[model samples]
Target: MTTTPKHDERIATMTFASVYPHYVTKVEKKGRTKAELHQVIRWLTGFDDVRLQELIIENVTFKTFFEQATINPNAHLIKGVICGYRIEDIETPLTKEVRYLDKLVDELAKGRKMEKILRSTS
Candidate 1:
């Protein structure tokens, strides 16, 4: 019964561009390439490189980002703990989507195989 923290409100309003660098930094610190990070983001959000760049240039908030996203049907396959919260256990739809991205980035940082992280478990 964990309540949504006040900080989550700020997170929802934060721009994707503002957070993009941190994601790049996290993955790059573990020897992952920015292209790989892009691939994961595209896989989750259905944003191609050009569209992704547009969102960054426009400084879209996470709430707006997900609002416009064509989230992959397989996204629910992403299951894990991130920042002490289980992705599947998150109650708010928007928060769960945000955490889904976080979990994917965490996997990328941890060096999980791209196919596994993308849940291409076929």
Candidate 2:
């Protein structure tokens, strides 16, 4: 008998609060700005704390990495490191789809196919 693997759909709907316990609570605390919250997420996800701290000090927020992963319905973060990256580095398919949509928008804009301009450049 052959069996196919069952797909899980609940994986993508997870928020930071669900994946990382108390993550939201941590962000709500004082002294942790939005930028710092992103840094903490990065650190938890696999980016080196030292490296993240350096980048955070420079005002660089890498939240997109995490935001990208929560959109997938079958994606989940493992409890180990892979190729020097944490499992949290894995992105959700939903976010990937959103990125594709964004790319499409850019392509459409370059082609001047959009009727109304959503952006203004002077």
Give the per-residue lDDT of model 1 (tens digit) for 1-122. Answer: 33376757876898999989999999999999999999999999999999999999999999999999999999999987887888778887888898899999999999999999999968
Q: How many backbone clashes does candidate 2 have?
A: 5
Worst 10 residues of 2 by lDDT: 1-10
Q: How far out, in Å, is residue 101 in model 2?
A: 22
Evaluate residue 52 in candidate 2 and report its C-alpha lDDT on the 0 to 100 scale.
44
- Each candidate's number of clashing pairs is 0, 5
User: Model 2 off-target regions past 4 Å?
Assistant: 1-44, 63-122
TM-score of 1: 0.93
All candidates: TM-score: 0.93, 0.22
Model 2 lDDT per residue over 9-121, tens place: 23233332333324334444533344444443342344455644554354432234344333322223212342232334335444333233233233332443222212222
